[model samples]
Each structure stands twice: as C-alpha cells, then as structure tokens.
Target: MSPEPTVEQLIAAARAGATGDDELALLDAVIAVTKDLSSHADEAVDQVVRQVRAAGHSWTVIGERLGVSRQAARQRYADRVERIREAAATGSVIHGRDLESSLSSALAAARADGLAEAGTEHLLLGLLTDGVAAATLEQLGATRDKIREASHRLFEHPTDWPGGGVPVFSAEAEAALAAARQLANERTPDCAPIIVNTPQLLAVIATNPGSRARRVLNHLGVDVADIKRLLHCYINVPRTPFGRRSRRGRGGKKQRDRCSFCGHPRSEERRLVAGPDVWICAECVALCAEMLAQPADGGV
Candidate 1:
C-alpha cells in the first residue's frame, strides 16, 4: 500500500482543492492536518522521554538534552509519565511499541477534535493506527476514514477547552486499557511482565458492549463477537515444547511445530493435537468442526 500523505502533502492538496466559496473548509482541513502533525510530534517526544526515563536517566539529564531546566521538563511531562508508570506498575504491564503508537494516534484524534478527554471512540481510532488491530479491522471492512466519519456523526463533540492542554483518557478509555493489560497478563507466564499489544487493546475495546468504540464498530457493520473470536484465534497460537526459551530441537537442530491447516505456532492458550507428520491447533480444530456442522446446502 502507498504511504499516507504527509501533513505538507495534505495541506497542498487542501489548498489546491480550495475554491473561493470554500475557503473556510480549506482552512479547516489545514487546521486538522496541522493538529495531526503536532500530535505526532508530541507522541514522539513522549515515547523518547519514556525510553530515556526507562534507561535510568534523570529528569535533569532529560532537561539538558531538551535545552530546558529540569523543573520545566518535570512540570511538562511528569504527570503524563507518572500516570503511565502507575498504570503499568500495578499489573506489571508493559506497553508494546504498537500499543504506544496506537494510543498516541488515539490521543491525537481526540486532540484534533479539541476534546478534553480521549474516550472509547478515540481508542477505537487508535487501534486503527497500525498493527494487527488495523489489519483485522481492514479485513472486516472498517477503514480509518469510515470510522472517523461514523464516529463524528454518532458521537458528540464538546466545545474546545480554554487551555490547549493534552487531553486525558476518559474513564472508559482507561478501563479498556486496563482490561487489555489484564488480558495480556493472563496469557503470560508467571513473573514475566505482560506486554499489551494492539490486538489485545482492540479486543478489549471491541468486546465492551457499552463502550462508544464498540458502538461505532457496530455502526460500521463490524461484528464485535466476530472480532473477539478472530483476535482470540490469532492470539491463542499453540505453544511449542521449546516455549520461546530453546531454539534447539533434538540433537541441537532447530524445530518448530505449527498448525498444518492455519500455520500458527504453538502458544499457551491453544494446544496442538498431533497427527502423522502434521499438527492442528485447537482453534483450527474447532473451526473445522464448526464448518462441518453446517448443512450441505448452507455453505461455510
């Protein structure tokens, strides 16, 4: 697929399309794209700051790098960084890179609309930012533009706040994130920090019946249950005996057992049932059974 248009490209396109009568619309488009650019810049900073902090660098060092005083650096990012730390500290949840990017996109979407809080709809939009969630949504016929339009139509937008502070995640958005962390944690081995990925976040958001995100997805004719099942199947690959620790098979040869039908590797949740020179995961078996259960006249 072609790369998304850059902010400059979008702005040029907007200017080119402007007619005298539609100057206001053109201006709005410029504002939107610029806000997107700003949001991306902020996200980049946030990610880098988090990484620097994680590397045990002090705020003083960070401030020096950014050409600011330590106090100023702390004042600007302390709350956001601390909030993220607190959330992960509780469950030992680590945000994967894609999750972080998706969240940044979600926050950007909310900020672009001048919302005071990023809610479930924003989370849904964030899930489409990239990664497995984006691919899954695409397969289900939900595009970013479609979701954005439906969200704008179905959701209410509050007036822009007086100050241009970064928007906080709404309670529902926080809960959804927390739920995703828990789900990831559940699938992990004991004592290992759980890394929340985009698929996990998307699954939690899609499964929440009362969430605006789920409502928007439903509005676009995407089935939440199907999403849940599909994500589960993707996540629940059968675990190999090696189990991410050992690469060597018998006699120091590397071996990997995967589902013959679906080709998914082994995972904790889904076990493989072995056959002669082949293997099948539980998910694929269940899928095959379901397909076979259908009547001949009713195609799978």
Candidate 2:
C-alpha cells in the first residue's frame, strides 16, 4: 500500500544498498535484456553504415575503427564494397531494419535449401516481401517467373560454379545484398527502377565467370554497361564502367564503327542481310516475318 519510491528516493536507496534481493534480480534481468537489445541495435547500425559506405562512403571513420589510415581502408574496401552495394540496390527495398531482417532471412533460406553464397535469385526472394523496393521491382516488370527462371539457370548450370567452393554463404555476397536492400529502401519516387538493362544484364552474366546466369544473360543480348548504370543510380554510387580500359580499342574508334545489322552503333553480334536495306540481326530477322504476320492494331 505504500507509494512507490520517487527518482530521488530510488537514487538514495541505490546509494545506500537498500533495495531487496528479489527486486535487484528483476532489475538485473531487465538490464540484461537491455544490453542484448543494445547489442542488436549496434549491429543494425553497423549494417546501415557499412551499406552506405560501400555505396561510396569515405574511409576516415571506417579506418579509425579498424586501426588503419583512411587511405588504407579505402584501398582495401572501395571497389569490393561498391560492387556489393551495386548488386544489392537493384530495385529492392533493402535498408535499415528491413535490410537486416531480409538478409538474415535470406541467409537462413539459402542454408535450408542447401545453397552456398546468396545469389541474385536469393536476393529476388528477399525482394518478394511487401516493401517499397518490392513494389518498385513489380512496377518495373521484375516478375516472380523471371526471377525463378534466372535462379534455376544460376543454380543448375555446370558453368555457374560459385566462388571458393564453400558450402556456406560468402560474407561478400551477403554484404552485397544487404547494401543493395538498403539502397533500394532509400530510393525516392522520382528514381528509376534498378532493373538490369539488356546490355548490362549480359555483362553481369558474362563477368560472373562461370555462372549459368551469366551465360543466360549473354544469350539474351543484355548489355553490361546499362545494368551497371542502373545499379549505380539505384545504389546512389558513382558509376564507373568495369573493364573500360580493356574495352578501349577492342572495337575500332566510335565514329567509324558501324553496326553490321542496322548500320548504327548498337550492333547485334550476329547479322544477316536478306536484301539491300533489309539488314537485321539474326534474332530480329527470325522474328520480323512473325511480327509482320500479325494483324495491325486497327484491323477488324
């Protein structure tokens, strides 16, 4: 029936060791839970900071924690982080607590499915949840069917061997997805969807080294540069073309080069000319007559 102790009274009691053992145990439990929650909160904070930094945060702070100079951390993680962030931010709401939960769930799912490092397909699953990034992906035509197909190709093909040959997820891959989720979540309405463009998609597949996804993407004639650009914009990172130095002079100077199929800069790898002024890429030529065979929009 007595009134509860006031703040000053409680302070005085604590100083005097006047609290009962049962009350102290309860307080200790509460303190323990608080510490656990604080630990979790710290992890969440670290994840967000790491994601943003990967998208191109300077290393002065990152280095200070690692006991290294800013330049050292930058050199160590700049490209690796940028690539990981780019991959993750592709049209998904993957940030803050949402990103952490999604990534943790994804890793769990991959493990349950007996998969190695979390792939793009796994990332797609993370995006299936109801969120801003998922909405963006849906709006931009990233359907479950396409994702499933992509995943199948990535997992089944002999060429799609994951790096390191480890059965567990790679830290890099997980971090990439986390960064991407954060970037996707952070995007504004005016931002474009981070769907990989044809060329860019092709490049991702190709650069995957031995990934089946890379092979499939290449077969589809997607562009690597476009995919990278989409990812860069989505992740809010500076866009820098990979292998730009190698691509230089691989095809002659830009002005003189002509597309064999259309006489434009965007050349199809395979070309055919049915007649003069009837040039087309092999795929286009095959589809041309079928498209022409269809009734016009205004036809009865």
Candidate 3:
C-alpha cells in the first residue's frame, strides 16, 4: 500500500484545492484529513500527555500549557490513562473484531435510546441483537423486546432524548471491559496476544454483580448460574478438548451432543447419559463434576 499522506501534504492539497476553486477536490482533501485526525486524536493526545508527565510536569503545568483547568485535564484523560497502565500491568491486548462490533452496537443502542452515555446495561442491550453473544442470550430468554422493556422500566428516560457527540462509557462499562480482558487471558493463556471476543465480554459483564448488565439480566429473570457455566464452553475451539461435534449424520438426521447439566455444546460422538428431563454429555460429567458436586443452590 502507498504511504499515508503527511499532515503537511494534506494541508497543502487542501489549500491548493480551495485556492483553485475546486469545491469537490477541496471537500475530498479536507474530509480525508478530518477522518484520519478524528480517528487517532485520542491516542495521539494520550501519548503526549504521558511523555510530558514522565518528564516531571505537574498537572497544573500541563493544564496551563493546554489552556484547560487541572481538574478538566484529569477528568478528560484519567480513565484512558488508568486503563493503559492496567493493561501494561497485565499484558498486551486488544478487542477482537466481534467484540469491537458489539461495542459499536452498544454505542449505537445508547444513542438510539437517547442516552448520553453507554452503560453496562446498554452493553447488554446492544448484544441482544447480534454477535456471538446473541445465541446464548437468546437461549436465556433475553430477546430484544424483553431487554428493552426491562431497561425502560429500570431506568426511565425522556421520550424526546436529545442528540449529542460521541457517547462516553460509564464507569461500570469500563470495569466490564477490564474484566473481559482478564477473562480472555484465563480463557486462552497458550494463545499469545489475547484478543477479547464477544463471549468473553458477555461473560465478564454478566458475572459482574456491580454492573448494570447483571441487573438487567436479573430483571429479565435469567439464570445467571447457567450462563456462567455455559460461558466456559464458548471460550475457543482450542480450549474445547471434548472433540469436534457433528450436527449431521449419514441420513442427514439431527444429532444431539450437548451436556444438559453445564450446557456444553460443540462436541463430537460423545456419549450422553439420558435422564428424565435432562441428559448429561460425557464431557460435562467429566469436567463439571465438582460444580455438580456442589449444593444445588442457585438452581445449579
């Protein structure tokens, strides 16, 4: 691919297009540079802030240089700064494509609802429609309609929600993201450079008692215990040593290989012990024995 145009080159082109009275050319140049600048603005600012702080600059001094109050500066950069530090303390990481899409949908959902910020509830609401988490959520009875009713009931909002700039993530939402990173690491240690996928993100949010996501799930009368146990099976294909599951046989008939107790699916040729209402797959019996051993409290 060709090298990206430099800022100076972009400015020159924009100026030339404007001076030449070519409206279309000018719009193109300006729009291209604006896209690049807007997309990378946060990272660039964070790097600069870190460099100056490392050089022993005080918040007041930095604020003075940036023409903003110290409190304003802290409020603007603190979450991202802390998250970056936290990530370094853990390991290199990033959101997988699926997770990214879910988050984007989360923001879109918040905007559509007329909310100013995307909270954990919004994150859960966003997952109701699409991505890897959708199937599990559907199985748990968290359809789009039900979640919308729950959220609307839990947090009442004005019907005429106003428009705004990009929505900021709530503190709980940020914590859920951090939690997702941790879960992703545990899910795939052998796999280097962990990528946080949809299932991991959903697991973290659903398990966090302090998050609104969990509250929404509870309001919807979901079985959180079942979700947690089932989330283990969605980690990754490499983690599922139970073997590949074949959904079809010679006659093209359907086959069932799911573990009834833990809801562990994606298995192949695994023997399942049939019960009155539930069947336990071989893998679940072997791996989830201890969990099954616990008191059947929480309806486990």
Candidate 4:
C-alpha cells in the first residue's frame, strides 16, 4: 500500500479534480441551469411563503430572511398568501353564466351521485356539460354521457351524504380552483384580473392527470396525455395573427403553413377553416365548436 495519505495531500487531490478553468466552466454551466431551476420553482417559493406565514412569521421577519424590506415582502407575497389562505378570495372571482351553470351542475352532479362534497370529479362532470369545456373534453374522448357515467362508478356512494345544506367543495376541488386561477393568469398576462371561464378551467383540469377528475376521465378511456398536448397548444402556446406560433409576416400578412389557432399543419387539419384573414385548423375547431353549439340552444 502507498504511504498513509496526509490530510493536506488528500485536500490537494480533491481540489485538483474540481479546480481550474475546466471546472470553472462546469460551475458556470451549473449556475446557468440553477437559474433555470429557480425560475421554474416559482410555485415552490409560493408554497414556502404560505408555510412561513402559517407559522406566524411577520413580514419583517420573512423579509429579513428573504433579504428584502418588510414592505417588499408584503407587496410581493402577502396578497398571494392571503388568497391561498382564504377560500372566498378565489370563490369571489366573478364567473360568467356558463361558469354559474357549471358550478350549479357540479353541485347537482354530487347530489345525484350521493357524494358528500363536490370533489374535482363532480366539477369535471360539470365541465363536461358546459359549452366550450364540453367541446374541449370531447376532443379527449370524454363525452358528457361517458364522463357522467364514469363519475358514478369511480367511488361507492355513502347513503348519508345528507340532503339539506349546499354541497361544499372538497379541499382538492378548492386547490384545483386556485390552480385554475393561476393557470389563467399565466396564459393571459395582457388580460388583467382574469376571471376564469369554463374552457379555462377545463384546460387546467385536463392536464392535471393526478386529480380525481382525471381518474374518472381515465375510466372513460379518455386519452389524458393527448388532452394535455392539445390543451398545451390551445392555452399555452402563443398564437400568431394567423393562428400559428411559427408563422411569420410578409407584407404584414401571414406566410406560415400552420393553423393560426393551433400550430398543426394543413395535413393534421383537413378542413382548413378560414375567416377574413386568419385560419383555424380542424383539430382546434373541436375546442371552439361550442362557440357554434351553445348559441343554438345557447347551451348545446
């Protein structure tokens, strides 16, 4: 065996492996990736803010920990923390007629299925009955009747769900509602004070595969992954004036070969629906179909 390694020798060996310009380059790359991680961890930061607030830390103290002034802390995070703490903060957001109908239907679905509280499942079933949302779900194979039937079989009913008071939302349902608000905010920065519509909520739910609503969707043979992909294009991907993100302007007019509403090409979208200028593909048509369907019954 070699002579017993001295501490200084070990230190020198260890430092040599992770030192010099090569190591510095590696460190720089790690720093870049870490910045990306921090940007993506906004939700984690929000959660931690809630935790510290729940522990009764004042803004001043939290600010000190965050290396900011108390006012900065309060301004940056207090309202958001308050919203998470209060259910009514989220519930108070103005909802349209379609939203009102959806909520009422959600409550009704729970009542019909004999569930104690209206969980995300009922909310999803409610969405499946709503105009735009129903159309959006239809693309994922979650038809109104299929999802409704599946919701019934997802859980055994308790006879003692009680008949008197209004159906309250479960914790999970409330979380999903809050997430809907967040998703709407993320998608529409220009539209300040966005009150989520039914389609927006459905967009959020379709991607949340871990939720009870998604499980019910799974039972109905709905392709959750495909729903997620379509909604990502529908809600998250930026649309050009011609409806395709990759499209460019020549003579201030669309020149790209993709749909103005969805990035799908002419092949994926067979019909190639067009307006005065912009065109929407066949796939995206399913999401906005209720724009046509609903006005006929005003609820179709």
lDDT at 161, model 3? 67
**Best-fitting candidate, scored by TM-score:** 1
Clash number for every model?
A: 5, 18, 1, 4
Order candidates by lDDT, high to low.
1, 3, 4, 2
All candidates: TM-score: 0.52, 0.29, 0.50, 0.51
Q: Tens digit of lDDT per residue, candidate 4, span 1-300?
A: 001111111222223233343333322223222222221123234434665676666878767656689999899988865654453334345353455688789988887777668988888878765545665676666766887777667777777756776778888888888887666555432312244556557766666868888788778777766665645543553423222244447666765565555445677426676643445566555544322222223221
Could you tell which candidate, 1 or 2, scores higher by TM-score? 1
lDDT at position 174, candidate 2: 46
Question: Model 3, 106-205: lDDT tens per residue?
Answer: 8888888888789988888776544457757887778878887888888877687668677878887888888888776655434233557667778888
In candidate 1, residue 40 scores what lDDT?
Answer: 25
Task: Give the TM-score comparing model 2 with the true structure, all chains together.
Answer: 0.29
* Candidate 2 residue lDDT tens string, 37-118: 3212232223333444635545776666446799986786666445435544563431333344444655654554456666
List runs of model 1 lying over 4 Å from the truth.
Answer: 1-91, 159-163, 237-300
Off by over 4 Å in 4: 1-94, 139-141, 191-193, 229-233, 237-260, 263-295, 298-300
Candidate of highest lDDT: 1
Better of 2 and 3 by TM-score: 3
Q: In model 3, state the lDDT of residue 209.
A: 81
**In terms of lDDT, which candidate is stronger, 1 or 2?**
1
Q: Report RMSD (Å) for each prediction in the order shown.
A: 17.5, 23.9, 20.3, 20.9
